[model samples]
Target: MSEFIQEKRQYPRKSLEKTAEVLDNDTGLSLGILEDVSKGGFSILTDQGMRPSETRNVTLVLPGPQGSPHKVSLTAECIWCQTITERADFAAGFALRSIEDQDEVALNYYIRDYQVAGQKAGELEES
Candidate 1:
């Protein structure tokens, strides 16, 4: 049985259109690109049929916000996976798998920025 783990912070991330591969245990099955990201979770858009309630090993290679490509590999299980018939994109939301210490630091910084910006925006909205 696989254990579910969540991160401390949820980052607000942008859409990353890069090649991403999803692995089940030690076997490679399908590939997709990361759609949107956050520290707590992320959504992937893929045409392949992957079970949501199962654990998976995912490796995502994307260009970081600085415009350099960075690879992040982690173990994640699909909390919710669905196929969108009305829309062209299918989304799969997964918990943070296992966020590494280094990645957590980066994610914390990103999440902090996201929270600050959101707070500022909310304040502005009231104005």
Candidate 2:
């Protein structure tokens, strides 16, 4: 028998046209490519594994109003991480813990305007 799983996400997630790059703020190193994002959290596809409950200061490079890249800084806590056997990469989910007012505004704009499922872009349907 198949069991039903309840959805727990507060905000809807939107995938990007080109994967956004996630960076470790402290080290300025590339952490991974942002797979999808929402107001509350985001997920990353990375080469390195992340432990659950781990906290990080990260910057996301997102597509801006006119094809330019905009960076949004925030503190995030890792919620889960799993390995993709075929790709040999890790996919990690993180919840937003903190963000500056300006960064938060920018993130909201990116989600509303540039995302694949966003009104302006309207490229891919939301998953």
Candidate 3:
């Protein structure tokens, strides 16, 4: 196992209010945006849905201030999930994979914005 050094930066995570889509590769399902996201992955809150076990494609459109948004399409896999009592949602962990260098740059840039605003890189989730 290789060690993934967590990027040294501010953890700016904001609760997601906009609607995002998650397209299922096998069943063609679109899981709505739950809440919170980061360059690492996201937390999906749903009534209760089965997720893919294998590595699948996950696309997310992140909206920044000033109507400037960056769309990211990358490969990720469902690692684990759990339902918490505090919130009625499934907090899942996803290992980002096959990310384009440009996408990584964009992710960094997004975080940079937060840093510029004296915040950290977080999207209602963890990075």
Candidate 4:
């Protein structure tokens, strides 16, 4: 029998029209691509494994207004991680810990406009 897990999210996650790439700010390494996002947290599909409770400074490359690429920098804490592929690809969940006011605004705009429910993955609306 499968064990049931309760959903503890404060905000509902939304699927992105286009996946955003997440990078480690300190190392300039590509951590992963964002799979789903919410106001509180997000999940990424990555090749790197992260331990729960680990913290990192990250930059999210988001699709901006007028087709420009906007980068939002923030600190995040890992909530959970699981290996998802035979080649050791992992899916990790992270909670946003800190963000600048301007970056928060940009993130909110990206979540609102770029992530619409029922939109097919990688299908972005024309600007």
TM values, all candidates: 0.58, 0.86, 0.57, 0.84
Roughly what TM-score does model 1 have, to 2 decimal places?
0.58
Order the candidate numbers by TM-score, best to worst.
Answer: 2, 4, 1, 3
Clashes of 4: 0
lDDT of 4 by residue, 44-106 (tens): 999988999999899998777777889999999999999897533999999999999999988
Cα miss at 43, model 2 (Å)? 0.2
List candidate 3 segments past 4 Å from native.
Answer: 1-29, 51-53, 84-89, 115-127
- Alpha-carbon lDDT of model 2: 0.86
TM-score of 2: 0.86
What tens digits encode model 2's per-residue C-alpha lDDT throughout 1-127?
Answer: 6598777888888876686899999999999999889989999999999999999999999876667889999999999999986643999999999999999988887776654744464564443
TM-score of 4: 0.84
Flag the better candidate by lDDT, 1 or 4.
4
Worst 10 residues of 2 by lDDT: 118-127
- Indicate whether candidate 2 or candidate 3 has the larger lDDT: 2
Instruction: Determine the backbone clash count of candidate 2.
Output: 0
Query: Candidate 1 overall Cα lDDT vs. reference?
Result: 0.58
Ten residues in a row with the worst lDDT in model 4?
A: 118-127
Best model number under lDDT: 2
Q: What's the count of clashing pairs in each model shown?
A: 2, 0, 14, 0
Report the lDDT of model 1 for residue 43: 72
Q: Model 1 Cα displacement at 122 (Å)? A: 13
